[model samples]
Target: MRLDKFLKVSRIIKRRTLAKEVADQGRILINGDQAKASSNVKIGDTLTIRFGQKLVTARVNDLKETTKKEDASELYEIIKEERIEDSHLL
Candidate 1:
């Protein structure tokens, strides 16, 4: 599955266009490497996403073209989520 589609299907980003825009801005990484919106996402791949001050890392657990809301959370397992502290604020 494409990264953008996977994000939306998994309900991680809420929208495919938003995922694409985030990926294009270099705010997403796959397996520790920067990824594009069209990047291929496979089962077991680790994804790290930056959302403003938060960083979320998840491992892909499943893939589907479409999933119900109840099933979306099963697509990935969150490995870590942390708030990025701005050093400038210190």
Candidate 2:
């Protein structure tokens, strides 16, 4: 599955376009490297998404084209979440 679509299908980002934009702007990384919206997603891959002042890390647990809302969380496991201090660049 695509990175952007996976994010949306997994209910992480909520929208595919937003996910694409985020990925394009380098706010999303896979396996510690910046990834594009078209990047392939598979099991066991770690993803880090930066949302404003927060960062969310998750490891892919499974791959699916579609899933129910109740089962969306099964797609990935949250590894860590933390706040990013000092939004203004030096």
Q: Which candidate leads the pack in lDDT?
A: 1
Least accurate stretch of 10 residues (summed lDDT) in model 2?
81-90
TM-score (C-alpha, index-matched) for candidate 1: 0.94
Tens-digit lDDT string for candidate 2 (18-66)? 9999999888889988899999998999999888998899999998999
lDDT of 1 by residue, 2-90 (tens): 99999999999999999999999899999999999999999999999988888899999999999999999999999999898872311
Query: Which ten residues in a row are the worst by lDDT in model 1?
Result: 81-90
Over all chains combined, what TM-score does candidate 2 have? 0.94
TM-score for each model: 0.94, 0.94
Relative to the true structure, how large is the alpha-carbon lDDT of every model? 0.94, 0.92
